[model samples]
Target: MTAVGAPQERAELAPLVTEPERPAPARRSPRRRGRMASWLLYAALAAVTVAFVYPFVWLVSASFKPRSEVFDNKLIPDTFTLDNYVQVWHEAPMALWLLNTVIVTVLATAAVTVSSAMVAWGFSYFRFRGRGPLFGLVLATMMLPGAVTMIPTYLIWNSLGQVGTLTPLWAQNLFGSAFYIFLLRQFFLGLPRELFEAARMDGANQWQVFTRIALPLTRPALVVTALFEFQAAWTDLMRPLIYLRDSSTFTIPRGLKAMLDQFGFGGEWHWEIVVTASVIATVPMIVLFFLGQRHFVEGIATTGSKG
Candidate 1:
């Protein structure tokens, strides 16, 4: 090989010039990672909240809108009016229907709560033969389809000459609900047997023990049962439809059905009034749910945790 020139030799001997290596990216700390996860969770929750709440918000907005603009799909109304609300009261016996709903709900809720608590206390406190089998039978009743019993129930009610009034709507609740009994029984079982023994030592009767100790300790469960029954009675349309022949006896749901017939299907295109009434019907339930939300959640949590 030919000898290289001095400049070429010097150039070859020089170190190669290249870009410096970058430092590896800093690893995320646990706190940073947790913050990121929390933000993501918050964003997801906000999205779900909007998804669930937007329809109700739209309904409320529509209720305040003019008839032509009610279905315009706008969240904000260009023309706002309370005329729909005002006119709905005049068009229907809204006050009477509301009163009937309140009465029925209160009666049914009270009946079921007391009856179910009593049954639950018996199941929890009493140690007797066939107790398990008896509870199993009670639970089994829940499996029977409402449709299967509807005709028989109606016949029984008809035989008693109480089919037409609000009696059927609430009277059935005089017998403890299987599900409520089960829920409350779990709470009762979690109570220390020694507490009842102490109460007994103190000369407290079984009724006293239940009233003073069981009911107070298991208040959350009772509230849950009452709330559930209240919702059921408040929204019950089936019994009302089956028995209520007169418009004067109609509850909210039955009244709403009549209003739908009048406004939605009938010649009267007063859909705004229907929407307004819907808003009225829905607000009470929302208010109640918010009020009982803490007890509701606590009751469910405690029930699930208990035996």
Candidate 2:
């Protein structure tokens, strides 16, 4: 009987040992697999990052390289120089173009920010007849391509005697933009109503509540919207081309094109200067984007939160 009991005990011990060993193997397998997957995900992200970064790297590198070396596809040049920048400065009215762009972008962005915020505040806080329809109209305008209205817009500006002037370029923002209005409206809607109510109880009017409480809380959205407007104004080629007939009034894009035209296709082609101009044109927008990146992301994230 003792021997039989010993055998049964050994059998139970064996089962327990085998069960622990099985879990150990399974756990090891999953851990190894998880590590492999993690590595793969990181690798993929690195690849994507490189893919996006490569173009800007090439553009910057090309700006410093000679025309003959631009198409070499090399990651780094054996020789880099600032001759392109010097030539671009001397040849084109780059400084003037940059100044014009800055003026238009700053004014337009300011107009859009203030007007859009006001409209958004009204739409969100005020109860009025046709409010929903008005907001719908704003959204609907976004669906209409700019190309569709370009000719008509040009004609209207021309009739208003604003053609061939910077007024036409910046005047469009006087009425604000549909997209920006919608964006700001959505952002305004996300604010806590209690804050506004409390402000009202404290003798704060609507304008005071907006200027103090709403604007402060919506800084991220405002910054992002202003940045977007700035970029659009800076990079705009068509509006400037259509409205600006004077070289002195040209924006960077228009100035770049004019430079290309002046150089032509023959021996006069200054690829270095053109490349440098392109780089300079891109720098301000890049700086603005990096500076406002955090706010931009936050604004987009919160824009639709309450809507």
Candidate 3:
């Protein structure tokens, strides 16, 4: 009788062993949220990239499109034509303009790099009276708008009989630029002082120390400065407009402007030709940037770190 009662009690308890029925909470996992956020961020970046890159793509496509399709907003043209480039080459003195640009840009870049680096070395290594104040003054000059002194600068160049020449355009940079001086000074300051001291101990004169020790170590900075100044001279329009009087002396920027001015915007618009000229003019600068890009980044990083 005891055995039978124990079996009956065990069977009754088995039915109550199951859990109460309830719904599970619908919360997202952390990994799921993170993945969603990453996707959103990528989407935003892609949109911004498209916005900036679309214009350049359109410009290149327009250069290849027929005149009737030049103004179209499509990235792929309905009809492609090389006549625009052909006309640009025939109608404009692009070769002469490119040659002039090359001369001015190279000269200006070399001069500015040398002058600015020398000035920067002085500011970094030499301890002189009012040195800080003088550097401050140089930086202050950068704050003033170019327009404020444009007329006075033009008049001064006119007095020197260089107003209608590329000499006036590049002469100012050869003296040194405030911004370039600042950039090079930061890089020079970051260099190892012990090396410079050792060179001096070995009877190295100031010029010798500068040329042999400092310059070789600061190659990255120099390349960056040269690239910057090169691009500045390459794209300068106002300076060329003010200085270059003869058509033969016009730089690429000035020549392109002349083409636009000659062809009024309307039914007679020469959009395709102008775009073609622009594409040709832009290639050199792009190539230069890519070639010096590694040094450029290193220089910026070195200067920024020390600053």
- Indicate which candidate wins on lDDT: 1
| lDDT values for all models | 0.88, 0.83, 0.85
Candidate 2 Cα errors over 4 Å, as ranges? 1-29, 264-267, 300-307
TM-score of 3: 0.85
Over the stretch 1-307, how does candidate 2's per-residue lDDT look in tens digits? 1223356657766554565434443423678796888799999999999999998888799888876786677779767877788777888788998998989988999999999899889899889999989888888998999899999999999999988778888877978888888888877888899999999999999899999999999887788889888888889988998999989999899998887777645458766677678889888878987898897777667556744
Per-residue lDDT of model 3, residues 1-307, tens digit only? 1223357757666445423532232233466876888799999999999999788798889989988898887888889788988888797899999998999998899999999999999999999999999999988988999999999999999999886678987878878998889998987898889998999999999999999999999887888899878888999999999888998899999998887877535345877888889899888877887998887677667566655
Query: Candidate 2 overall Cα lDDT vs. reference?
Result: 0.83
lDDT of 1 by residue, 210-295 (tens): 99988999998899999888888999888999988789888899999999999988879888988889888889899989999987
Ten residues in a row with the worst lDDT in model 3? 18-27
Q: What TM-score, computed on C-alpha atoms, does each candidate reach?
A: 0.86, 0.84, 0.85
**Tell me, what's the RMSD of every candidate?**
15.2, 10.5, 14.5
lDDT score at residue 11, model 1, on the 0-100 scale: 59
- Candidate 1 runs further than 4 Å off: 1-40, 300-307
Selected candidate, larger lDDT, 2 vs 3: 3
